[model samples]
Target: MNYSLFAKVFVAVIVIQSFIILIGGQLNIIRVDRLIQQREYEYDRKDMLVVQDAYNHKLKQIRTNVLSLFFDSTQSESILEKIKRYKGTTKAEDLTLQAEIQQFLQSMAYTDESIRSILFVRNSDEQKFAFVRYFDPSLLPNFESMISLKEDEFVKVYPVDASPTKQVLIFILKVNDPNTVGMKQTVGNLVVSIDTGFLQIEGDPLHADSIIELKNSNGTIRMSGNSFAADISQIDLDARKHDSKDYFVTQVDNTVDDMVFTMLISKKQLKQSLFAMKKNQWMTIVAIVFLNVFIAFYISRALSKRVNTVTRNMRKYTPGEFVNPILIQKQDEFTVLEETYNQLILKLSEFIQKEYVMEIKSKEAELQLLHSQVNPHFLSNMLEILRMQAIKENNLNLSDTIYQLSEIFRWNIRNKETVVTLYEELYYIEYYLKLQQFRFPKLQFRIVLPQNLQNQRIVKFSVQPIVENVFKHAMNKGKETDIHIQVIEAYDSIRVSVKDNGKGMVADDLDLLILKMQKPLADTKDTPSVGLMNVHARLQLIFGEPHGLEVQSQIGEGTKVILHIPKNEVGP
Candidate 1:
């Protein structure tokens, strides 16, 4: 073949390959996205497994320490009987018990945040000590009232409060102390509330992706290993349908109760693992494509420069300053390309100018979209100031709360419109609460987020404002306030809850608010309450009518707001 014709054929082949490569690159990108999701699931699952193991180990440790204390050679039924029988109405015995309990707790590596209370109830007089490094005399209760009557033999019981001031696991032991053991008798019950505050993965970076739970033989969740809501009952029910290894069963402590032990890893780890695998694959493909494009461009440019020289001379044949137009000696594809390039450029310029005018004219129609025009720079500064003030006033909690709030806003501004993994959202909430807590230090707030939700993606700020509202209206005004925030991840959808112990709204207030929250600004004469209205509007925009804010509140009791949003918003 002629060299020129061969050159043309080579260029055509290169162009075709480029198009094919582009399609393949996009396909690889798609594959990588799916793989990354899989890896994320896997990582999350593995993390959950690790967390479960660690938690069970800790629980076992607590159980061992408590049992050992009762079963020690120094402790006996007679000794325990004497201690119970010798108790006086005066706070003297209570003080002795408190000292012993505190000494035991400290020796056993139990921090104040972990052991909320240690109480010893006697037959004649009741005395106990409740200390978390500090004293809580009111937490002492009658040992007889809290005892389990289900079994006749000496047994250890883990009792969750009917209404826990905080999410914690409480362990109760009824065994012989030294005094009672000497008399060959078992008398008083030793009750210790192992506050789960210490159990929370406070400084752990991966806490959001981890989960732990303790389950009974009946599949009821006796106490959770982590701060997550108990789903061990469901795990047991679901496990029955599958083989043993694949199923979720409670990790066993055969020494204590011989409960079947198993841990189903969070599926998020699997997802993460798969995602990493695909990321590697796509990254390799991208690198290859990029190299191919670079080589192709270099070769094409060399050839184009030669052709341009010939064309330039032909155009300048009669030129001094202004050059003569190119007179083609032959008609071919290059001639067609030259003609089309000039015409396309002309048309593109015209189109750009037209679009510019149209964009300005359409600005009026886009007033609503302008809500996204918030300047993060200004907001960040304000948050810093708020945090500093909280710290200066001995409001470390409030300072942390402000910091969290800033983080939520930062994430919102920085990661706009991108589908965030559920773990990411939890992180945002954790920080948001740090800021809110500074404002309401007396309020009790706990989050029971799903451990396996790393695979799921949600709209940003999905659960934030509902939590904000709890503090704004209900939590800040009251003393001894409480709120339980839980995020339940289901197969089809995710449920977000913000339940508060505060003065709640009446039915008519609900009626007026719900309607206003849902309606557009034009429809409503006035804005619904700030936080609620913004949350309602944002959720409506993202999830549409299928998911919106639902509030349940009774005047004297409290408020519970539930947000239900679909799990699968985008295809992998």
Candidate 2:
């Protein structure tokens, strides 16, 4: 997408951070959900325990009150004797005993609001005495059917419908003759009906959909705190099914009765709570991601700005032009790079200045040397006329001398080429030396050139300058100055050496002359060694090093100057 550094950094940081945050948030949500489930389970368990305890306590209290009514000093003997003496007789005592029992039951019902009715049955005639409160006659048959008890059971509790709308818990106790031992003799039965409403939990449930159920071991519900249509047993109560239709079931077994107390808490409320938590967590994660992206953007922008500054400065630079150094406020890697670039620019500037000036000077020296030469046509015509005049007078030596001078002038003037063959240059050098011999009769010279090297090409005036320097500076006044010019070939280049048995320079003078030749042409222009320096500079500027001049000399030994030239075919 060609995204900039800032965008790349910001996106990378946000993506990485958001991924981590999302993963961590998901894990946190799972952990919190588990913790909330555990808390709900424990809370529901406590509520079930509370309901169980209350029911057990109420049952125990009912049992105690009922037993107290029979076992009381005044009531125990009267009720036991009356129940034992009764045999379905309509005597005044029996009627009176039934009236007393009814009055006692009424009193007990008035004292305990949970009690609905009490029944007394005589086993001798199967006659029933009942004190009914808010009773339905239609339910009398169902109540009578549950009154029968097993011979070995002392007491039994059952949940039965007292009326179409009223439900009660019936506690049946067997009345036995205490005077008879071994197999106790049955006298009567006492059945107390306590309203099932007393078994309900008192307080509101923990959640709106929470239900508390009281059921027997056989799964028949006796009482419930909340009205629920669906059977709790049919619903999936697994905690892991929180995402689906599920409930958290908590059950407790009552010690006073063979009953189970269950609390059903719907997962709908839990799911809602978890969704809200996840929303808040995602909001926090998004906020953190944005903050991190902002920081990354700021850092990337600062770095990009520094890099751009460097690039802008570099773009402004051109060869042979000055460039300003980059100014960086911070001392970091960029600062080091800026400093290195500045140093490189400075070195480049110095190199360009040196090479540029040297090129201009070399061209100016060549033009000046060319302008100083005599007009070729006029010099050649005058030299030929002088040679003809010497021949006309029969002066053979003078005519030959004039002819050699004309040949030297013709070679120098007629050739406009920058390069020439070694043989042509040597022909010019021989004529110049012959003319020099005319001036100094003691000057003697010999030229030795290999036949293969005759066609070696060099700059036109390369050899003449060194030979002129030898003649001007190395010639002795009176002694015979023997000059030997020899050409040698190497693997990659050619060398031309000029040796002379003349007044050779001392070590100090030779060193000074060599130093002057190596200096800039402007510095040596007024010096006598200008010709030598011109030749050295031209060779270097044209061919580059190591294609220049080298000199060897001593106080007594003659000086030898070698011209190093590259091997090339003669120019057309």
Alpha carbon lDDT of each predicted model = 0.57, 0.73
**Model 2's TM-score against the true structure:** 0.42
Off by over 4 Å in 1: 1-375, 378-406, 476-478, 517-530, 569-572
Local lDDT at 73 for model 2: 71
lDDT tens readout by residue for model 1, 1-572: 45798899998987887678667866876787667545644554454455455446655665565555544365453223334544444588755654555565454545444665555554334444333443332353643444543445454544343242344445555555455446345455555555544434532313432334444432223333343344433444344425433323224344545333233444444456556755575466568879999999997995586479556655544412333333445566567755654455456655665466445433632442355446675788899998999889999866776777787667766764535777777777777666555666775678787666555666666576677677667753547777787878766678878888887899999888887776643232222223666556545555666776788899979999987777763445
**Candidate 2: where is the Cα deviation over 4 Å?**
1-309, 324-374, 520-530
Using lDDT as the measure, the top candidate is 2
Give the per-residue lDDT digits (tens) of candidate 2, residues 1-572: 69999999999998898888888888989998889777877877887777777667766776666464445575545555665665556889777877776777677778877777777777777677777886532255555555566788776677664544456667777777666896378776777777766645444343556665566732244333333434434544344334334667777877766887767777776798789877787687777768999999998998999888878878888898787777657888788887888788889997898788777665765776577475766888998998899899999988888888888777766776767889988988898898888878888899999999999987778888788877778776778889899999998999999888877889999898888877655253532224777778767766776788898987667889999999986745
Checking candidate 2 for backbone clashes, the offending pairs are none
For candidate 2, the 10 contiguous residues with the lowest summed lDDT are 217-226
